[model samples]
Target: NNMAEAIASAIISYKKEYFGSQADVNYDKTLSSKAAESTKSKRIADNKVLKARNSNVVFKVQFAAGNKKIKLNPSNFKGLKNVSVRTRNGSFYKYAYGDTSDYAVAKKDLKEVKSKGYTAAYIIAFRDGKSISVEEAIKL
Candidate 1:
């Protein structure tokens, strides 16, 4: 992906440089305007693409506690792959099935789960089974 990005950038730059050298007055003005417009359009497109790629897909977790609820964010767990909710006192609970259910269970468990200073209800971007920055994940 990096290589592809580099090549695409080179091509765009090459086009800009090549077209910037027109001899005709009208042709040069038109080409320059078009190039500038193209560059602006590309920048906007790139921003959208980057935002989508880096955007995080968050999974909320909630657990039950008496009649209350506890919400757990991604940071609550060290390894989030096999997410499960259990009591901090050493009692294993059931695994949350759906995204909503899992988040609910995690929220409920938050009361018992010790916090390591992570925020609640935020997005988490992952790539190749490894966590990535939100900006990078948004590209996906």
Candidate 2:
């Protein structure tokens, strides 16, 4: 019975993999079947996470970091548009300019950001709204 349960689970998994979410499992009261259903659901969730991580990689030119929140306005950012803020911890704020997916464009924006007297401006990358290393962003 154990072997039968294991084999049934494998077949259900295979169907889910090849047929996508349309592959529905007929649930039974057995414990093994419930376990298989849980496993399949977890796999589906993992796949979704992977897809999200691989998409939406964006680059921004970080121009300021401080412990206080600055009002996000053109006057606050030396007239730079498309400025955004990412908060660290709870109170600390990092101000960045430009939203772009092109690395070359971000580098260009960094130059402009530095010209505005933010001499230490640098490029940062994010995937799925979480900060990621630029090197890792490049690989993604």
Candidate 3:
């Protein structure tokens, strides 16, 4: 009796943690083993939301930010992967480069980008698509 209850609770917790919302629980009550596999399958689905396979936080170099109609070109940062431009507020756009889950790697990346002519580039971290500091990102 408690086994079913335990499985249900575990599934619910896993769903809420990974999916950010409730999911339809339609598993057979008699199959506790199947529930475990279902939970593992769900983790795979949530992997795309992650920055790195293991890290929930990552650092990027914010090369530009403005409220004007100015365009931000992530393509300008050549040879860099994970280059992206995201809007924080409704209007202001922020351009960033690099996707590293490690703080030391990000710090080194900052230096490398700086040397490559991005003199003002700096590290800005993100977890689940929200801006954070390198220190905070490392903690996550």
lDDT of each: 0.34, 0.63, 0.53
lDDT of 2 by residue, 36-107 (tens): 433443344344322223558988877665566778888988899889986645555667899887666776
Give stretches of model 2 more than 4 Å off: 1-55
Give per-residue lDDT, candidate 2, residue 7. Answer: 69
TM-score of each: 0.22, 0.59, 0.50
Candidate 3 Cα RMSD after full superposition onto the native fold (Å):
16.9
Q: After superposition, how far is residue 113 of candidate 3 from its true place, in Å?
A: 1.6
Ten residues in a row with the worst lDDT in model 3?
21-30
Candidate 3's residue-wise lDDT over 46-84, tens digit each?
Answer: 443333344667777655444443343534555555567
Model 2: per-residue Cα lDDT at residue 50: 23
Span of 10 residues, lowest total lDDT, candidate 1: 61-70
For TM-score, candidate 2 versus 3, the one ahead is 2
Question: Model 2 lDDT vs. the true structure?
Answer: 0.63
Error of 1 at 41 (Å): 22
> C-alpha displacement of 129 in model 3, angstroms?
2.0
**What digit string (tens of lDDT, one per residue) describes model 1 on residues 15-74?**
533443223222122324334433443344356542342223433332112112224444
| Model 3 ranges off by over 4 Å | 1-54, 68-75, 78-81
Query: How much is 75 displaced in model 1, in angstroms?
Result: 20
Could you tell which candidate, 1 or 2, scores higher by TM-score?
Answer: 2
Model 1 residue runs over 4 Å out of place are 1-119
